[model samples]
Target chain A: MSTSKFVRQGFPLWLLAGLLTACTTTTVDEFRQGETGIESHEAIVILGRRQGSTYETREEFVNCVGERVSRGSGAIRVIPEKEFVDSLFPWFEPRTAPLRTSDLQALMEEQVVADKIEEYGVRYIVWVDGQTETTNRTGSISCAVGPGGGGCFGFGSWEDDSNFDARVWDVSSFANVGTISTDATGQSYVPAVVVPIPLIARVEANACSSLATQLQQFVNGD
Target chain B: MFAVTGNRKTTATRSLRVLAVLGMLALLSACGASSLVVEGSYPTPAVRKIPLSLGLYLDENLRNFLYIEYTETGAEEYRVSSGQTHVQMFSNLLPAMFERVQVLESMDDAAAAGVDAVFAPSIEEFQLALPQKTRLDSYEVWVKYNMRLLGPDGAYIADWVLTSYGKTPMEGLLSVEGGINEATVSALRDLASNFTLSFGAVPEVRDWLASRQNVVSNQ
Candidate 1:
């Protein structure tokens, strides 16, 4: 084979491998207590656990999960976490939110809370707790500009891991119906010559998608 | 040679002017104080109201409170406008906890009519922690208040410090002012929730309620 031809073909193959390396790997684990199903009129609420001292469950991630769960035909109705928490006010604030299934009974005993719960027809309360962390970083890229112009010359790679768990509570039964946990990990690279090219990893997005899918199937009794 | 010297002198003068302008801009930015205002309407609590008409006195000190904290060298100032929002929140909170509340202007007015209890709440301390100081991704606020529960005859039933805390995560590009404001509102919500859930749990308040019950039963 001619040297020029071999170089062109090998370059495409190398780029393909780089792209594949940027992809995320996700795993989901689900545990259901028993047969589970949701009525069409009922709704679900996904809330992020935010009481930790070292870390907070990101609000954007919780909303992403909500959006993912509530898509497509015959999609489940979802009550936004903020709206539901505000409708109940002090009861559902981070400090006062029930930490266990048993606490739900006492919370529902309040007449106004009971009435509001009935009004929303909320069936499941999904409590998601976790954080997405940039695990490891390597290499460095530096750029500068002068009268002649400048560019970056470096190749850097970093890993991100997203691990999260969701606990589903059946509001009517006042019991925890199921739990689903998901984790996604990916490596991203930035290689620069004249300009920097980023092969970004969407580990957080991957975790959200799979968790939402598992939650939907678990709730719909599929 | 003369032309080269003149060019050098001009270049140096222009550079000095640029440096002076940059220094002035820095000073101006430091001197300008930032104001934080908390604004979130409190929701009516769902707890059963205490079955008694109450006299509520929100004093001017609590209504128009502002805290100004200056740096050690006094180069910058941080002001928190919290008093008005405190009034707004307590207005909703007090009504929800009692059967009827009469807004009183002074403690002397508490002696006027058919009121069984009175409450006067005041700020004790306010503290703010920025992310830069804490080396954390959160902006936190702590609010301390003296919750005074008084009898109709100006007797102190209970005087206790009710402290609440709140923190908001400062992700990516959120402004420090917005983060602190969010934390303040969260702390206010927390204070309302703490008061609502713990009112009957406070020892002095519990004793007073029990005494009131005894007197009613004896009657």
Candidate 2:
């Protein structure tokens, strides 16, 4: 191909590549120490801290982490957030309030709670807490609903940042073992011209994977 | 002047091509989706004192979107919202059905938890659908699950797969979002019921339980 022809073809390809790269930007951070004494056969229950009407946990983020932890950590089983609630909600309901590790011991003292724990063979309970928010936004987009379907026009951009922390508590000892956290930020852009093109960063998903991997490593003590 | 005109034409052509490519991509990506939480409890068999360890392995896609197929355009896209994720559905509902079930967060935790055996579930095929172009219609969700059973020693006991379906009618009075949530609730309930029905009947699981019982008796 002529140099001019090559330039014409290569330019768009480069631009496309750049756009794709910009879309997938994510940072995963974690820390851990020696074997935390958790065994492979034990169970870790991930719970969401309730905040009034809503829970502190994000459904997508929790599930993502649970899936990754199960897959990444060999055969290590993860007690999903849903199961955690099903198993523990009854005890929690009495309080009509949120629970901290401090409250578990007293509850554990109860025969029913203790029996349930032993029955379930729960080793550690992980509490996930955090939220994702739009940190910043600049630009505007407008839409018009016409008889012929509908359309949006203009350009809009927003930045979403997610901050989450995973706290591990050993059920047997009723002690807090360690904590892992993730802070992921994603930017979204919408360019509307008859249609809107959205570029979503998936920051929460990144946070999920990061937290899950780190929690696995922390529990495995590897 | 001729050379200048030729370069301008090339530039314009390149710009148009770029715009065309972007436009196509945008059009293809027009589908919108949302996620919902699946909530509810299902009836399980009688309580067994011997605790069973349960593990869930969800497909990453299930955590992301609900796949909806448009009949008009013959286009398939992951564009349904869910209140609860696939992981949440299994994790939350499974324990309710069983009396002495331990839902492990990680496989490593299972060994220490003193579980006799483990159940690992993975998604095979999952889809949620409603008639295309109609805001008011019944919504349906279906899933195929691939399951694996392992002993405490990590021995592979059994591998099986099961499919389940759920449906809910959309009331015209409710908003579109509300209808979607109702559908999700129904789908989750059916999936949980299906799990209890099939999982209890698995021979490998029975064998494993018997073996575990023997070990307990000896101890």
Candidate 3:
């Protein structure tokens, strides 16, 4: 091919490569310790663990996972974190929440707590704990407006890493049926010429989907 | 001659408008204050009420507690009015935990009348930290409470000091006032959770309950 023809052909390939690089890499792992299955009248509650000093399991991620797990084939009823926590009130508050399966035995002795749990027909408690962080930022785009006009002219990029872990507790048996861990990482770019165009990666969303899928399969005994 | 007067009047009117706008801007800048009120509501706890009539003394100081802080330059002021939230929290949790509760105007008035016990809850100390000031990722609030328990005869039974800490992650879009209010509400929830689950474990409280049981058994 001629040199001019070759150069023109390479531009599309470069663009394709840039688009692909914006995709996030995700992985989901599961560890099962007991049998898992849900009944027609049973529901699962998903709560985010927020005890970490430096990081918080974002509420948005918890809601996303709950919405995901509540739909599709073999879909089960899922209780929202806020509603479930509020329904239980002080018992499920961060300061008083049970940290171990064994603690539930003591908590259930409260009578009121046990009664409420039974009323909700909750069979599993899923505790999600994780956060998404953006780091390794590079490049910068500067834009200034003048009396005449203004435009951006530079490139900026950053890496996003999302790590999450979910533990499923069988309320009836007071056992941790299994645990799921998910991780997603991606690079985002903003190549500005006149107007800044952001090719952002959906790291947190990808991780949520991966985790929710695994949870559905695990709950259905797949 | 007519044109000159008309031009002068127009200029004077324009100048006055400009001065009025400047004055309003100056007033706004001079009053750089942040006042936070708790917009969140408390959730009722699911607890078996203790089978004892009680009198609760919620004093003015505890009902209208406000924390104020100013920047070193005194150009900006931060205020957290947590009194209403704390009052609502106590009101909700106490009724859930006790069979009968009488709101007392003063400790002396009802402490020795129509109740088996009198309970008084007060804020001892409250502290708040900003992310920029503490180099932390969250805004934090710390509260210390003095829980006073009294017998039917207005005699002091126990004075327990309880401490609670709560923090909310700082977000890029969350304002300082919103963060402060969130942390304060979190701290209030923490206090209620702790007091609810563990109050019976206190030795004095346990003893008082046992004594009441003994008296009831004799009766």
Candidate 4:
């Protein structure tokens, strides 16, 4: 059988192999361990995510950072997305008009940090950017395909991988504080919508914990 | 003929398998899509009432008759001016306050018609205090208002004072019309809501009247 024909015939072995190869191994040791280079800052201001139709999960990452920073000696603050937008450009309402990335970057550089320095007595700022991707694999067994080709034992498996990347910036000296990447995968089998196979939750939790731990290390300097 | 029939059956089976697989993919995608979730929460004041119209005078400069200009800083001046105009178009769109005031007045009128009580007009004054070093361009508005209840005795029954402030940063530009107008409107809405809550919570008038009637009966 021709390879293309084989692929068309629902043989996903090659695709699965490629995805497996693409998965990178990350270890605790691979992550930078200490904050030896970090300076003692008076405050930490968490940046809001970019504006879009959908809500961004960066706020979760921000809360994680805020939790970690509060344990340290620094005063932790979150600039309300509205206040930040108003104080920075005061012109572009993100609610109505989507802010361009370039414009956002410029506002971050010129308005946010400058005003924080002046009004909030902020000496240091922590800026975080986050993005997530997801993939899922499913299998089923059926005696016969139902309406619209629905059935089980027409065994099908799908594999999906999403990448979550976050970067933290230090405002005082305008340096990158740290960066983190995480991946989450999920899989399910048909005939039982109730049972999730339990791995999907574990995968997502592991990704969240890994990101949080990386940020904590940055905050702790350990 | 038999061989051709077998080939046709095999093809049908394979097609069925492909269709089943696609259905499974669709179900899986739907499940995964529904799993991502986000939530938000905001802090709300436990009690939102400020009592009104026991009077306190502000400096004459802070009175409502002053004309002010609004200005913008940096590159944002243009876009924000447009945004301000958009916001200003509906500046008086809060009809709820007027509705509530009308309802309250009607209730008071009914009460007076029954000779149970008399209704008196309440006075509200908003004041703005410019920060020292007048060149600094800081603006803060203070609002005060009072309400009193009078019965057949023509005596003061109850009263209270309400005050709140709104502040804006100092920009060198000399226009307060557009800039302070937005802030002032927002502050006034909040003030009105607070006043309504306080007015709804008045117990002193009813309690004092009850106590005085009891004393007269006992004597």
State TM-scores per candidate.
Answer: 0.85, 0.46, 0.89, 0.33
User: In lDDT terms, which candidate is top?
Assistant: 3
Residues B1-219, model 3: lDDT tens digits = 999999999999999999999999999867877777775677887888888888888889998998887787865488788888887888888888888988788877774568988988999999999988898878999999999898767798878999988888787535887888888888888888889877888899989888888987899
TM-score, predicted candidate 1 vs. hidden true structure: 0.85
TM-score for the A-chain in each candidate structure: 0.89, 0.77, 0.90, 0.49
Native interface contacts retained, candidate 4 = 0.00
Q: What lDDT score belongs to each candidate, Candidate 1 first?
A: 0.87, 0.64, 0.88, 0.43
User: What is the fnat score of candidate 2?
Assistant: 0.00
The candidate maximizing TM-score is 3
Candidate 2 structure quality by residue, lDDT tens digits, B97-150? 444456665666667767656667766676766644445346666777777777
The lDDT-based order of candidates, best leading, equals: 3, 1, 2, 4
Candidate 1 error regions (>4 Å): A1-21, B1-29, B72-74, B211-219
Shift in Å, residue B196, candidate 3 = 0.8
lDDT of 4 at A140: 59
For each prediction in turn, the share of the native Cα contacts (below 8 Å between chains A and B) that it retains comes to 0.57, 0.00, 0.87, 0.00
Query: Compared with the real two-chain complex, what DockQ does model 2 have?
Result: 0.02
Q: Rank the candidates by TM-score, best first.
A: 3, 1, 2, 4
Q: How far is candidate 4 from the true structure (C-alpha RMSD, Å)?
A: 23.1
DockQ for every model, please: 0.51, 0.02, 0.68, 0.02
| lDDT by residue for model 4 (B48-141), tens | 1222212211212322133222223322111111123212211222222122111122333433343433333333665544444255445555
